[model samples]
Target: MAEAPTDPSHPAAFWDARYAEPGYAYGEEPNAWLVRQSERLPTEGAALVPAAGEGRDAVWLAQRGLRVTAVDLSREGLAKTGRLAASRAVEVETVHADLQDWTWPVEGVDVVALSFVHASPLFRAEMHRRAAGALAPGGLLVIEGFHVGQLVYREVSGGPPRADMLFTADLLREDFAGLEVVELEEAETVLREGIYHDGPAHVVHGVFRKA
Candidate 1:
């Protein structure tokens, strides 16, 4: 994967260093599957993107007229987000905080986008549940991430080191219990994001709506 997260003791520092690199660590463009599901997003409303690394997705949402809040533990990542947002002439509220401790806006947002966020198994369910709780009635939560099957890709893959950090449709379905499942699938896709995430990837993609 991408350099096996250097400062594991302080994951934020690791991410900050990665984002502090010369160019967008994962590329300037939003994740391909996210763009594909954009039509399902609210036309005008609030969106919360946790672990929003470099703001590609947040910027895209803002461009489409959604008020977006992009949160991450890495200050450098959020700073890159600000730079990218400004470059695109869009406004994205950047929050620098660990998602675990941040006060999520409960039932206040219209959408939540989680793309390639590799949460450890211990935190994954809690994270997804909180994100789902933040959605308003009928609000949507769209996610795309590496599946456990991605382990086969090994060094060529771009996901969490531990298999538990990966995702499965069943896991997500159980985690988002109160939401109606609009879509869920595990599949293989060719990724073209940047140096960090470029290769064949096994992924889980899902779109769930709050009841």
Candidate 2:
């Protein structure tokens, strides 16, 4: 992946430019892995989605009858999310903010879902902590993204080119330390979402439940 800009406003500016391009960066559908794990998700509850680019995952959650909140740094991306929600006849609350600096809710949501948010290691750890803390009792957190092994396929993996941003099963277990690991694994798979993630890939998929 490209390096996030260093200037304070550059991250948003950069993402705005990216999302401002022609089509959805990833796609307009929920992640395939998330779809497979949907049975564990509550049909009606509040969900928080961080780094919800173009709101596909967030919009999908809303379609499932959940009140969903999607937070992202790019205003343009959120705008697209709103349009997508309108197109789907669903509602997704879009929040424009930087995850690195935002205060994550504690015990306030029934689900927290993150997909392919490849931030720098420190911010990534913080986001994981926020995700774990956001869950209410018996709440679930679903995260799926590129495995560290994807570095080998950087040319076509569609993951961050940086190894620190990529993940391993152990990394996730450590990041979400307090949650109960309902399922955690890493494997090879094919991603056929959009122009962004379209190829064979190595990935990690996990579901953690709060007690």
Candidate 3:
């Protein structure tokens, strides 16, 4: 495995190289958790997908009749997302910007979908804040990531190796104190993607609604 970048800029380059291939690094399907939680999304509202690797989930949201914006640090990843959106005949806004530094949309979003967005501790907290703040009243925040216990099932194949980068329900609850928890649970599920995350793994999935 490539060493985790000591400098923050190194991660963009790392992800850019990983997404340089012709196809998406994680395939074209929306994550199962996101799919399962789609029913909870508002029908007529804007959706924000941060750290959206290749627009699969964004495209999926667009198909569900929601206006979507997909954001990622890697230009290459955003390019792929645009291509996929075009191919799918879906109109989606693809933004290539670092989540930690990007200017968030001033228009409150109705839903924010954060899937497997593992990053440094500081960035993670900022992302959580931004995600929660982006939502309008009665909006939803859907998140899924490798939990701390996932290390036992999948070793180091998925998510950040630094334990601090991963999430726990307690951390999420603390970060989203203003929101009402709709669903939060940790479960062992089969992650079917490419060679990277193909196995039974532990994950934390949560849905919170702003009051």
Candidate 4:
């Protein structure tokens, strides 16, 4: 059996190697929720996608006529995203930076999209704050990730192992205190990734609008 890749010490390197393969790590399409919510997103506004692995979401947003800036620590991932954007004939700004240390834009982004970005609790809180602070008034923030119950399915440990790393509706509500909670729910979904996440999983999806 292949060993699970869960080393938090060098996530950039791990993900970089994982994405160095021939194709996208999570497929070429965008997340289902993002596609469904595209109508709600502003057509000509800037979007920030932090920890944007392989840039699927960012590229999709760009294709929808949104100016997108995607940041990821992994060079390999950013390269793949750039290639995808070029192939799709969409423009996107790609940045290679670690979210924990990189400076985020202040009060300009119309949307901040975080999809399946797992981090330490402290870092996660900081990320949430940065994402919230980067948004302009009435801007939208979309987040989707696994919840605690996700550990029960498939036994395929791919996400953050610490339960604290998993998100809940209450946690999001608390972290993004001033945002209007447009939608929040816990649901079960199947991730159809290549060799990594391919099974049933419990997750929390949220959409918040800055007040």
Q: Per-residue lDDT tens digits of candidate 3, residues 23-129?
A: 66677888888899867877778999999988888988998888999999889888888888889898889888888788886438988998888878877777788
| Candidate 1 wrongly placed segments (more than 4 Å) | none
Reference-based lDDT, each prediction:
0.88, 0.87, 0.82, 0.85
Cα TM-score of candidate 4: 0.94
Please name the candidate that would achieve the greatest TM-score relative to the true structure: 1
Each model's Cα RMSD: 1.2, 2.1, 2.1, 1.8
What TM-score number comes out for model 3?
A: 0.92
Q: What is candidate 2's CA lDDT for residue 25?
A: 78
TM-score of each: 0.96, 0.94, 0.92, 0.94
Model 3 clashing-pair count: 0
In model 3, which range of ten residues has the least summed lDDT? 1-10
Extract clashing residue pairs from model 3: none
Task: Output candidate 4 Cα RMSD.
Answer: 1.8
Error of 4 at 141 (Å): 0.4
Candidate 2: stretches off by over 4 Å: 1-9
